[model samples]
Target: MGRRRTVHKKLPAHMHRKGNSYYFVQMVDGRRSWVPLGNDLAIARLKWAELTNIGDAEVEDITFAVAVARYRRDALPAKAAKTQEEYDRALDRLLAVFGKMPLDLIIPQYVRKYLDERKAKVAGNREKAVLSTVFNHAREWGYTKAANPCAGVKGNTETGRLRYIEDQELLAVLDHACRPLRDAMEIAYYTGQRPSDVLKLKRTDIREGTLFFRQKKTGTALRFAIDGPLFDVLLRITTDPIQIPAGAVRSLYLIQNEEGQQLGYRALNYRFNKACKAAGIPDFQFRDIRGKAGTDTEDVTGLGHAQRLLGHKNRKMTEHYIKERLGYRVAPTPKLLIKQKKRA
Candidate 1:
């Protein structure tokens, strides 16, 4: 009287074979959904058994996949949208390799092997960090008794981005940029804010002759007075507002397209890249504008000034950010006093 299984006849109840992968059909939020149990039949069988008996089992019967699923349900939503996207990607790789493996069976050697074998070294480092968090959660959930395997593993070495945009290069890029792109570029440079932060700016953020910013990544709140060149740019944007389409809500964002919609990350990036190419500037990114602001501020005043301007918590970070983009500047040694002493 029930649906008959003609395929994967050896598979247990509720297990369905599709393509090279196996899925377990279960009720999720009152709807039947297919949860991937991986391609290996042995591993899929183990996962299915664990999933079915999860409510009546001890920690020893739990799999890493169960822990990952619980984490996704309980913790993943708390992260920022961009952060959630990143974690989702990292978790996919981790789940593929460790999903059906028992939590206690994961060890330092296995963690290191995964890191070593991953092609994207930097991305592997990020995924390993996510894995470490998962392990921590697994311990709390009583899914694992073993310590986190990723604790002792070292990530691959990473080099900081050091490209600094010169004044002429910025001007050249500006010449090739469209109105919206030019506005975005000037705001990024003058405000010395991240590209995302710049695009998030709303007209309401300007209050009492100050532009307020609350950095999403660091939770750093900063306010810059509306004066000098910054005032000029803001005035230009206000006087030449983008034309809004009929029946569409006007965008509140400082940088918006002709349709009066907020400029998306992809659109801004594409325009920026095209402008850079037209300017004949290679290896230049929009983020480099913030670095130029730091370097220029340090040059005009001091490192402390740059640090404050960039909202860095410490001088070391600010120093590293600015570095010697245009190479080091050295003062000539003062005239020696020994010659006058010898003449005397």
Candidate 2:
């Protein structure tokens, strides 16, 4: 004979029935605070959910706006300037939509809806990243203990940056680019380094025949050989007689504004964009030059040999750049199948 089945009854959290009334167990000051929740199990369940989700000692009843404000005030200043700026842009959109929403209620589904409404993929992704950072900071600062809403919601497919600078476009843009942007673009092109890393270049970073520095994002120590074009740009900037500020040191940076100081990433981008527009080559950007280097290097030396040029520790990341330029279609054709008849 089969063994007798043992059964366990399911109960709504913190709920118990007595006669026609239902009571909920609410924790208060290490004591049970029995709250009346009426007789209907559905009503009791709703009441239980409401009470249980409320903030505990570690978590606070903080709104998303207040939490975000705290993060903006206390944490963002300690981050890299580039990172702060990007997060600031992302926050601009988030605050407009979820400023008053409770931090604990903003789940993955809510964030997905926010992402869908964004027209640009990159914009949506940036906002999602910023939100995650906000929640992480909130948890540490005792704002809320809810899981980050941005989790499990994947970012949109990024539109690959395909604009590469050719010889003619480079010449035209260089002819019109301001002094700061000219040096910035040329360095990025010759060395295949990020504009952020290139803009942070100090005059002291050059040694022997290579430019050596720790990459800002990855912390990878990179040493790129100074090609002929890079040497030419270096020579011009090194020799340029710019008026140094009252307290600023001369020759401190590889690229500088009119006042001899390190160029900022934001300032470089604004000026570079204007230069591209003026040169009738508005499509080209500073990053496109970096991509051009990757494409050119991959063609000449193959993917493995081009690894050092981009300063990536992993070859997979280096290959991503090369693959973008290859223009290879990813969609495969479906295999045709012939129908077969079966007989008994």
Candidate 3:
């Protein structure tokens, strides 16, 4: 028979090494339990000891599950709804792959593998970038001390394709569109504002025949005077005693239906695409009109000015729009010098 083991009266609230691995042996009075360190035994023991010494620290292991919960509650902001939603989705992806591993077990290599697996499924540079951001935030919050798993990870190098409508197609579509959609399309063209922003225009945003509003996406305040054609279009669409519901009465969207409710972006996109088909406009997209309008107005407002009015955060975005709208191609302009006939 094996000899009876002796129980210590008091247990040490620290981790210690056992043979080749580390173990966290905890004892509260006479009760005792131990957990093994899978791979990072040394580092795990040090972390466990440090946390225990910091009085009032919870004894439970800090798992990825706990860290994610903290990220959702303490890190994300209320105003950034879209960002929060994306973070939640990314964290869910991480959890599915890691399965509630200890927080410290999430090394850069593990993150890299997770990203690689996700890239195979989603196949977008943006998704990879978002994943990188999430892991970076995790590091910033002290959930991990390892290098970012997404750091130095290269993504597919393809740029997005630009789709635009020809002038004739645009004209045809405009001629066939219903009043609300027609005004919406025309305003998107003239103002170069995104569909979401255009749909939120209020009658009050126009003052002395000029349009002014703070862009929601980029937070840029814009002011621009409208031309006669655009002014006429606005006058045609204006409504008296705006009919929005009492709950949304204070909202300042200039474009509203008979009920005074602003048109939803998806609905507007669907209707606009339908309008294009009805008008027999081939290869036309709603966003193309904005680019076309900006190109046509380039002389009046420089490319930079148009880009700012469009609420583009960077010049490269403006350049892409300009290139697509104007069908611009860059080539070296050769410089030729001829000895002017001194005789002349």
Cα-based lDDT at residue 73, candidate 1: 52
- Residues 110-129 of candidate 3 have per-residue lDDT tens digits of 65565556545444355556
Where does candidate 1 clash, by residue pair?
none
Lowest summed lDDT across 10 adjacent residues in model 1 is found at 335-344
In candidate 1, which residue ranges exceed 4 Å CA deviation? 1-57, 324-328, 335-344
The local distance difference test score of model 1 is 0.85
Q: Give the candidate number with the greatest TM-score.
A: 1
The order by descending TM-score is: 1, 2, 3
- Candidate 1 on 201-294: residue-level lDDT in tens? 9999999999999988788999999999999999988877877778878878989987888898889999999999999997789999999998
Q: Name model 3 segments beyond 4 Å from true.
A: 1-64, 82-91, 98-123, 239-252, 280-283, 299-301, 313-317, 324-326, 329-344
Instruction: Indicate the TM-score of model 1.
Output: 0.81
Off by over 4 Å in 2: 1-60, 140-145, 240-251, 328-344
User: RMSD in Å for candidate 3, one decimal?
Assistant: 13.5
| Global lDDT scores for all candidate models | 0.85, 0.76, 0.64
Higher-ranked by TM-score: 2 or 3: 2
- RMSDs, each prediction? 7.5, 18.6, 13.5
